[model samples]
Target: EIYYNDTEAKKYAGNSRIIEIQTAMSERAIELLNLPNHPCYILDIGCGSGLSGEVLSDQGHTWVGVDISASMLGVAVSREVEGDLFNHDMGQGLFFRAGTFDAAISISAVQWLCNQDQAHHNVQRRLRKFFQSLYKCLVRGGKAVIQFYPENGQQMEMISSAAMISGFSGGFVVDYPNSTKAKKYFLCLCAGSAEMNYTVPAAKGLDEK
Candidate 1:
């Protein structure tokens, strides 16, 4: 498995190149979420070094982040982010009670669930469990914005289909589809409700409304 231990975690947080990439991705994901103009609790899945949580906190939302790597969590703890941090694997699913959060967000993390990290690692089963937990954790009409890089069409379909089966509405949103380099995919989901229209800034000019 590709472990994010202390040194790796330090580089992830401190390296100039990596920090920019992580911060950019986090900003884009939050932009797509179209959060309401109010305070709420958010869940940051695979939050490494609190980059995404920083964005959420800036918007005045309370958040709790979870990561599988203890070293990553340690780095996040040291960052003094306003959010809480937990060291846990998403594949095993979240342990929070039902309807515990107002929204959830993930960045560059869900793709790892597809890996056969161990002999017993089953991607389909694990993905279902994760989604089920995620769906239950959000209040009715809550949202989840997960940004990921799918290796192929099959992988993309698998992720979206799992979320749908877990009771999430909505699907992938691809920005800058014509631009091969800047293209980004965000899985936008609504819990137990229809997808609402998100006002993409006219300046960004995303093809979708």
Candidate 2:
């Protein structure tokens, strides 16, 4: 909220590099989701300026976007994005009915849960709450693909552990592992036991020159 003020939000929305990177990441996340080509209700966590939600909408999916920054949502509205928007903090937890979403995706979000913004902020507890709510709101076998930038290995481990503890089953997918600039981390999580056999897919361009 504070960091993404009105000016920052507008700049973020207007930046070509940011839009390109965000679009590519969102597309990759959706690919990892592996859902059929049909309309579904989706949740976009930390959907800043609806960049990722726009991708979801492009796939003909109905999506609800939630972000802590009102400024960002304002930008999204000004852009005439199609998804429903909400001004809420994900760390507190998603306040939706059980099995309300068919799938969930986040682009460059979720890692904010690690920041100890206030005196009462507990990183682990907040992560647990967020994942638990996400788990409950998704139908059994539903998946969530969250793309984030972890500051360190420990932060990545903490996030994965919390998701697993909250009953999500899946792991990380690193694209372009060999390229520092192009590398991206996506935590692909399933709400419950999936009918299909699941394995951690290998990283893309892992052996690229």
Candidate 3:
């Protein structure tokens, strides 16, 4: 919350490079969702400045966004984004009704769950609560694609394991794995029964292996 102060929020929302990358990542995350062309209700976790939600709006999907930073949400409100915005700390867990959303997406979020910023912060417990709540909120067969910059393999494993423990079945999809600047990690997840095989998307002209 402190990290994204008013000045920083304005700066972040105004940065062309940040906007471009965020838009690209949001588009990629939506692609991984593989939803029908029809509009669907979606959840945007850690939806800073509503940048990712803008992509959802452009695709004709209705969405609700939650973020921890008030300043960031201020920017979102000022932008008059279509999605409803909530100032929320996700680690406390989502309180949406059961099967409330058709799908979910998080861009450059989730990684914060791994960091223990305070004495009361338990990474494992928080992650478990988050995934469980998210799982319960999404409809059966619903999917979520979370794009994050993992600091290391351990963080990636921790996040994935938490999702599986919450009853989600899916795995990672790395895009542009060979390029340092362009490389991205997406945790593609499916809620409830796995009726379809979860296929990892091939890296764009790069070997993920």
Better of 1 and 2 by TM-score: 2
- TM-scores across all candidates? 0.89, 0.95, 0.94
Runs with alpha carbons beyond 4 Å of true place in candidate 1: 118-121, 194-209
Name the 10 consecutive residues with the lowest summed lDDT in model 2.
193-202
Using lDDT as the measure, what is the rank order of every candidate, best first?
3, 2, 1
Of 1 and 3, the candidate ranking higher by TM-score: 3
CA-lDDT, candidates in order: 0.84, 0.89, 0.90
Per-residue lDDT over 3-71 for candidate 2, one digit per residue giving the tens place of the 0 to 100 score = 599998998999999999999999999889988667999999999899888898888999999999999
Model 1 residue 39 CA deviation (Å) reads 1.0
RMSD after Cα superposition, model 3? 1.9
- Model 1's alpha-carbon lDDT is 0.84
Pairs clashing in candidate 3?
A: none
lDDT of 2 at 89: 88
**Residues 11-42 of candidate 1: C-alpha lDDT, one tens digit per residue:** 87898887777788888877767677889899
Candidate 3 to truth, TM: 0.94
lDDT of 3 by residue, 53-120 (tens): 99999999999999998999999999999999888888889989999999999999898888657443
Cα error, residue 146 of model 3, in Å, equals 0.3
